[model samples]
Target chain A: MIRTEQAEVVYPNGTRALAATSLTFAPGAFTVLLGPSGAGKSTLLRSLNGLVRLTAGKVVAEEADDLREPHALRRHRRRTGMVFQQHQLIGRATVLANVLTGRLGYHSGLRTLLPFSATEKRRALDAVARVGLIEYALRRCDQLSGGQQQRVGIARALVQEPALILADEPVASLDPATAERVLSLLHGICKADGIAAVVSLHQLEFARRFADRIVGLAKGAVVFDGSPSKLGRAETLRIYGAEPADNDEDSEEPLQLKTGTHA
Target chain B: MLAPSAGHIGILHEHRRAVLRHAGLVGVIVLVCFGALWLTGFFDAQRLIEGGPALGQLASEMVPPDFSRWRAWVGPLVDTLAMSIAGTALAIVISLPLALLAAPNTSPNFAVSQSCRLILSALRSVPELIMGIVFVAAVGFGALPGVLALALHSTGMVGKFYAEAIEHVDPRPLEAARAAGASRFQVITHAVLPQVLPQLADITIYRWEYHFRASTVLGIVGAGGIGFELIAALRVIRYDQVSAILITILLCVVVVDSLGAWLRKQLK
Candidate 1:
């Protein structure tokens, strides 16, 4: 299990991205972080792998030293896979080459200069097949569609054989159907592999559908932490800091007035 | 109505002022151009008309370019080509590391990046011809000086281009690599190089083409090549031989440019 001890993040420009908050991510559970934009979802998710250096406190993983130690941090990172919103594949490289990069941490820098071993190649190929992109394995990533590219990103992460997965708005750029498909693929993989996943998402529907547990945030602090069925309308309002638009007539009047003033 | 009309008049006045300002700037530019022409005696129509026959006579002398000396020109031609190829290879060797050091994303620290940039600028401040003269004086008259000059001068330009390419790579892939626990060197090889390889190749080939032309000029400064033979012919008033050498240089340049184009296509 990976956990943070009151970990917080304040960027150099003085933006309080995440308040001092502690949480534990258990193995074999899929946790979804639900929040509005800029509500510390990404900040908290990134801190788990030491990607966002916390301004205060530290992250601890089972059997590992404090993440502040470079050696321990690298070890933590090797077993942690991160998915990005932009899919982040090296566009000029083939899908196979991009997936093989996941195995880089398993070898020394000098050893990676040579071609990967056959076992490693087989593993990358298997990941590609799992993503259902076996036919496009040798094709350049730039030529793939956005959905396919995100799958390539997933394959790259999968080849790491990670114990934990962190995804930040991974489907924010895709269409509704494609988004659902990508999330399902990721959710299925994490379930089958028993990898703990901490995925931040903007869509409440997807979160409620796929999450084993839901953690909600607002203004850099968690407002609700429970199972998806337990997330009441009040809890949703607290997490988003607003009411659902369809039922909020009072809110609609104020919104219209604000836009009128702007005009 | 009166107040609104006054505001309209105020707007029109502002527009008129802007127009006047633009007109004044254009007038000043035209005056400076005429002044420069006058200073250079470029307006002397009488002298231009009178010089036509002199140019015609020079052209006449250059016709029927002497192929008699072609046998001796081969060695110098080869020397020029060799100098350019060797110089470009050496420049690429030096520039890649310097570029990596100078790029803000890859540099170890701000001081190293700034110092590397300073070195590139200092190298670039001197032209290849000037550097060729210095190298010739230092190494004595030979093709060695030409090669040295081309490499040093080209490094300045090639390194800056390479640094720019490296600096602009998509940072997302780098983040992904880092998050995957790849070492810094591993991240660079897998993420950075793959993104910028084609752009870097294009820059190197373009620089090689430019260096080929510059190497010929280096030969004029006692760095032995075809330019040296051309200059020798000029000294003896052998206009025909000079013309022949000029033609040879043009043909070689065309060949080099076409080769570079083909290589760039292959890279793509």
Candidate 2:
């Protein structure tokens, strides 16, 4: 299990992005960090991997070295895969090449200068196949649709063979249907692999549908943490500071409880 | 109402002052331009009119071109081409690391970045011709001096352009690479280089085209190229031969430019 201990992020400009708070993520569990924009959802997710250096606090994983040191941090990162909102693939590079970059951390920097080994190639190809982008493996990423690109990003992350996966607004830019499909794919993969996943999302429906447990935040503090079924109207108000205008249509069934169906 | 009116008048006064300040700056610029022209004797119409006949005589002498020494010219022409290619290749080799050091995103620290930038600026401050003369004096002439001059001068320009390209790359990819546990060197090779490679190629090709022309002139400083032949022709008052050499250089430049354009398209 990975956990933060009073982790906080105060930017150089003196903005408290995440207040001192602690949270734990267990193996084989899917946790969704649910909040509105500027609610510290991203900060909390990034803090787990040290992407956002904690101003005060520490992130510790069971049986791992201290994360504050550079060597330990890199080892932690190698075991932790991150999916970005922007998809972050090199546009001019082929899908296969981008996915292969996930294996970069596994080898020495100079070793990576040469072509990857056949075993590494096989792993990347398996990842591409897993993400259902096998046909587009040789195609440049820039040619793919937004949804397809995000799948490539997933494949890139998956090739790392990480124990923990952190996705920050992974489907924020996709359309509603595509977003749902992408999230389902991610959820199914993590479930089958039993990799811990902490995905941050502003979309109420997605968080409700997929989260094994929902951790809600408002203004840099965790307001609610419980199973999806327990996140009710009162809890939503506490997390959002007001009724979410977009969820009025589905307010009657706030927690859709679609988690087990996909898994 | 009175207080609001006073504020409006104050804004109006501020706007007028700003306009006057801009106008005064323009006036000074124009005055300086005219003063420069006057100092350079640009307004001397009498001298220009008197020089017209001499220019016509020189042009007349350049006609009925000589190609008798065409066989001897071939070696120097090849040397010019070789010097440019070698120089540009050398510059690119030297510039890549320097650019990495100079780029703010990739540099190890502020001091290194600033120092690299200072070096680039210092190198670029000297013209290629001046560098050629200095190299000739140091190395005792020949194509070696021309090659060194071109490489050093191009390194300054190419490194600066390369650093700018590196600096402006999308930071998102770099962040993604770092988050994946890739080392600094790995991040640069995998993320940074891919993004900037095309722009770097474009800059390098453009510089090569420029170096081809510059190398020709370096030959005039005893650096051994077609310019050496032109200079020799000039010394002997062989105007016809000089004109022929000029034509040869122009043709070669056109060929080099076309080659550059084709290479650019291939890269794209």
Candidate 3:
């Protein structure tokens, strides 16, 4: 239900990070944005919440105002949630308190300072439970594992009860097994909640294995868009510009170089 | 091991020469500064050696402090504690907003941040005693001047610490709040404040301690505290009363410091 229409983003230093690209995201779909680093993946995700502005174009949602207006933009962002690569939880605060922060935009400043209502507290706890961290609700974020901390990040987003969730490389710092687990959990949550998600990742195998639709970016342009089954060796070669170092289909080595050098 | 290469030896020799030169320079600078102090009679050890009897006589007079004048000393002791408490409370109130404005990441604009920093630096450049004298001149002698003096200087000290703490907050949490549709103030309250609260409390408590010590001496400039009473006793040659005042101030500081430490531990 959300789409970018000929969106372009140029940095202040004149780097055209995103060329004019038009793409529509379907509701309840787990879409993976696969690209090398600096391929405008983060920039594109950030724009969904108005964190990054489009230099020329419009980001719109059906039955809502154009997202370019400042007033409407903030309202749009309130309905959209984002997960950062870093866990981004306040390490000094309890996990439950961190999740409660997701409701800050909905409440008045005076209200936030006093205390949460019983219903709000229950919903925050529910979000924590949904992320499988209800046992750690009172624990500080610093004590949690990297994977757990990322789950707290997901919980924070979930508490917002957002319509659209944009995750930018959410599992880059985890081990291969943990990465698989978190991605599967994220995909399952999106389906169960009937919320659409656009997850950007550098790993192609996970994208192929988890995504209902795949949108590949190379050189800041969408090079491939199709079902996950269509993303085979030929598609990988086109996106990566070469056969991977060991494209044996089973090696756990990362598909794209971490530095994301173009072949 | 084989002999090292000539290039390596040459580099090592160069390093040794540099170290020797730096040592010689530091030694010469110390000698010059020490000679200057000696000629100015800043501290003459030979005079101290010769004045043992006078020093011993002075030390002997301070013991068994006469409590006969204790009734009069109580008012000023209480005044000193009150002055520091009020001043520190005032400083905390003023410094919190100024610190947020001065922090690079939290400031609304570059000009506003620079202005806040410059204003705080100007306040810090003046010593509390000089500030005490100025306030006393304006307000006419009382605890109010002492409180104002301590509050201004403490605001400078605590505000800088607050700005640094705010600047060091993790950017990711801030970004998350922004993406969650938080306004500027909401982001600061929800994300930035939680991370920096403990360190900010520590800095504020430390400034309170410093203000307590400063308030005790601020009365020497006629701003009204234990220092004023001690100076009066000194003029009347009542050394016993001066010792009583010193001991009272010491007890109060120790008790306050202990309470502060306990509270900080609880916060941790």
RMSD, one per candidate, in order: 4.2, 5.8, 3.0
For each candidate, give its TM-score against the true structure.
0.92, 0.92, 0.92
Q: What DockQ do you compute for every candidate structure?
A: 0.73, 0.60, 0.70
What are the per-residue Cα lDDT tens digits for candidate 3 across B188-255? Answer: 89899999999999988877777778888998999898888988888897777778788888888998
| Candidate 3 lDDT tens digits, A130-161 | 98999999999999999999998898888888
Candidate with top DockQ is 1
Q: What is the TM-score of chain A alone in each candidate?
A: 0.92, 0.92, 0.91
For candidate 2, the per-residue lDDT at B137 reads: 95
Q: Considering only N, C-alpha and C atoms within 3 Å, which residue pairs clash in candidate 1?
A: none
Rank by DockQ (best first): 1, 3, 2
- In Å, residue B88's CA in model 3 sits off its true spot by 0.9
Give lDDT: candidate 2, residue B143: 97
- Against the true structure, candidate 3 reaches a TM-score of 0.92
* Whole-model lDDT per candidate: 0.89, 0.89, 0.85
Tens-digit lDDT track of model 1 for A110-222 = 89789899999999999999999999999999999999999999999999999999999899888878898999999999999999999998777888899999999877888
lDDT tens digits, residue span B45-134, model 1: 999998999999988999988878888999999999899889999999999999999999988899999999999998888999999999
Off by over 4 Å in 3: A62-64, A245-263, B43-54
Quality of candidate 1 docking, DockQ: 0.73
Question: Model 2, range B1-268, lDDT digits (tens) per residue?
Answer: 3666888999999999999999999999999999999999989999989899999999999998888889999999999999999999999999999999999999999999999999999889999999999999999879999999999999999999999999999998888888888999999999999998999999999999999999888989999899899999999999999999999899999999999999999997
When summed lDDT is taken over every stretch of 10 residues in candidate 2 chain B, the lowest stretch is: B1-10
As a whole number from 0 to 100, the lDDT of residue B224 in candidate 2 is 89
